[model samples]
Target: MTAQVQSAYAALRPADVVLSPDDLGGARATRHSFSRSLVRRAVAGGWDITLGRADLDEHGCGVVVFDVSAEGHRWSFVAFSQTIDESDREDRVVASSWDVTAALVDGAVDDDDVARLRPEVIRQEQGRADERTLIWTRANRSGRFFEYVVDRLADGAQPEPGVFGLSPYLLRSTAFYSNGKFGLADFERFEHGHPFAVPYRAHMLSAWLLRELGYELAERCAAARSETAVRLDGDWRRYFGLGNATGLGMVPYVVNHPEVLDAWIRLRELPLADVVARTVDRTGPDVPRVRTLLERAARYLAEQGDTEPTPYTSGAKLAAGLRPIQDLLTEYATYGTMGGAIEAQPWQHLHEAAAAAGSEVRGVVASVLTELADDLDDVVEASLTCQERRDIDPKMRCGELRGLIDADYDWLREFDFTDPTQTERFWYSSANNEEPRRAYAGVDPGERVQHAVDVARAVHALSLDLAGAEAATSVGEFLLGHPWHRGAVARVQSVRDLEYAELHANLLAGDFLPLHVQRLQLAVYGMDNYNPQSTDWLRVTLFSGAPRVADLVDGTADDDWSFTPQPSEADERTYA
Candidate 1:
């Protein structure tokens, strides 16, 4: 699909399809009813799963080096599996030892690389960056399934895929490092495309590299147990996947990037709305394909067990709920869904069907849009661009400025994030390598040094200040008047056009937790294995492992190495 088709699809505004005023959840304040956040999160995570296979193709193992030929330097993540006292293991930001320790290897090295990386990767992760490495980090098996699967696999068996599910806490404990987050290379090497325009690709390189090292250890354990120099063959799913313990630090993205967030939601929602809006196949056989997609989504989600708020089952249940909407869509109501305004408008009918679905189905049907479009993933990836370039448009009239401020503050002020229901914790990156974490407002650790980058509150403040200021104030003038909120003002003033980006919360309020902000970000960018327990560490993947020499040799550039299929012709549609 071309970028033109993608953009044309995304440009469908709320006004184009909305029936009543049911835009933002309901009220004008809640008008952001179009939820791009959840759709984007699912798309990013799903994309990574597919990308993981590609990484596997690159490395011959279950991980692979991405498209990195422009810079031929081989950077591999050398992972080590050292059994530590389980009783002593912890998910705190300050814990020094983990079930695994990994380091990025620059080019092929002799004996010197192994000796240097072992102690250096371990201790420098204890906060020593002078190891002369590009990236260094470690992760505990966030799931007991790691040990369980190893036990099962060692007994000569393959564990079920369900063993690889993610938990919010484990999800919270995951982290990644760039440059020197834990004393590796400075981030500058990755800013341009050379070694890192591809962010997750680089970090996965490290994780996959480490996983290969685990194969060495597993081979050793197998040899000692069975009494031979046991060479291992076949891929092991039980021991794969990086473990991350996450917390509120990384769960807030669903609400923050409202516009970019909108892009993700819209892609999913628009397509879903389109599909449901279609005639229900009075004589067509395509209905089953749609139902099959829904079933696949439901089954995949069910495999995840559950998670709070938005449980894994929610996605499946969402699919089930839409079946009724499909039924409703079959026989047209006597009165048109939109009364008469958009009697023939398919998108408008979609809005009416969702509105009749109540809020729960409303949200669910809204989400089905993700599976409708051919280029949903592309729309999702496009949303990952940060609104760092957003500028405060100074051209708006003073009246508009005052109203936007008033409206923003009133909507955001409703949530008492400090209250148990509202503000349950605080978020911070621990000094122990800067991994993300969450603790009681006063207990966890660093409550004083909070990273309060919540855009909703910041934007609200900017609006209110602008509203109360002199009539002729430009956004720059307002920023100059209050320099502290400049970063936020820049974001708000510039990103007003992006409807799905803001989370409508005060990150500075006593209830604010930065981990939620971080998770929200990780989910949006699709960075898995980010441990929230390590507040200072942002666990990300790099080049994964090296791609298979066989595939590259066979001239099949389209190989999905993670789970490579039998060699085939060089089709031009490679999934990089």
Candidate 2:
């Protein structure tokens, strides 16, 4: 379709660009402290699973199923679980009997269809590529939350949120799937009619569907206990969200899809920089907006369930700094004013004050402010296109070779490879090339046989060699003399900003650490950030609190792919 057709294809319209990091940081101050990063911040804070809303945990079953429709467009989740031996239910890709395995079908399965497919879906490999399928997935139960919810609900009671002592709302976080990974809809299905618009927010949508499907499975299994066990009430049905755990595998995707990632990161960065840069008073329109934002954020923080909440000292510092700012602004402010007076850039002032207080709340504050700026297709619409398709002009001058690398990136050489700690860590793919495995120094077979694709070090080393190369030669010609950097040279030339992409530390050195490399990639992908010094920590957030298939019918307006609050006829509360 033409660009015009695509723009107006379904229901594309202009809306706010999206929250920026500065605004996000300011918003964070309204509630918590810590050098809040736009791309990095605490969310979902816990593993609580409730349906529809955070409250009403008593009726939760940690499982939900989607009801299928006929147009070949509808989808459903079929989750399976049995009291399997924990040893048999490992989370590895090779495990045969996972605690949960699911598949999406072309059409709704009646009792007969469901019965037949149950065995087939359980046969994950057998159904791995059924064309009509959009997504297929599984998760080993928390072993704790799974059994706890079942026991309590089976006994006609809600699971107390204390068996594990996490926030009551965060009990059911585990695993989920999305897209047409196995037998679900092809990614194209989501593109059809922009059906996924608004209600479809990536893998989380599927997880939410799985949550409902999980509830159904639990209800069916529990029906043997009592027919009354089924929660048929509207309120009972409207509670529950799914929790997911992802890992290092997600890091690469952010690097790969720069546009989408950039949309999120750039919007965050640009906005926060904008808000924090301002240095004015609180007499303008933003004062009240910030006040309301403070109220909501505080409410959100209170409502927040901390399987792990932002640290208290951090939270206190943020709160301590922000209240005074808000108070001052409110005292000097008028209602409904737009920007603060010429000198009263209240929003910007908040950033400055926080900065003085050593508050790094700018990230979350950016998110809050992003919600305020009423225009942002540019921010949210940033597309992720790979720019690594350049053909290296291997003919540049030798002097030019060293010049570009140093100027573009202050490439410098300083590392001792003989140190075991530096080169201690190694990355190798599984025999299948799917999972990435890390090994300690001197232990892994692929240590000396490692991939020489370390862009930064390679570039720096190339720079040093180029400087020493016979002069009066072009970079392309220099490559003829020193072909070792062929790969590095091509890569450096293609990527717009190589410095932003590579880890500064030398992996070959005894002090080489992979945690920062992993963290940076994860942060870029919008994945939750953590210090995974062990490389074993890998969890991602998907389908946590989003809409399901039903919303596709009822939710007409479209902005982002999120849940729309059903509007009352009087108020016309649209989700978009």
lDDT of each: 0.43, 0.43
| Candidates' RMSD to native | 9.9, 9.7
> On residues 35-76, what C-alpha lDDT tens digit does candidate 1 reach at each position?
122223223332221111222211122222222122444444
**lDDT digits (tens) for residues 260-291 of candidate 2:** 34343443444444444444445556656767
Q: How good is model 2 by TM-score?
A: 0.65
Task: Give stretches of model 2 more than 4 Å off.
Answer: 1-83, 105-127, 151-202, 215-241, 252-264, 270-289, 292-343, 352-360, 377-379, 385-390, 411-422, 430-434, 448-453, 470-472, 497-576
- Model 1's alpha-carbon lDDT is 0.43
Count of backbone clashes, every candidate in sequence: 108, 86
User: For candidate 2, which ten residues in a row score worst on lDDT?
Assistant: 30-39
Off by over 4 Å in 1: 1-73, 127-133, 160-173, 180-183, 186-195, 208-224, 227-240, 251-289, 302-410, 413-450, 453-468, 473-491, 508-522, 525-576
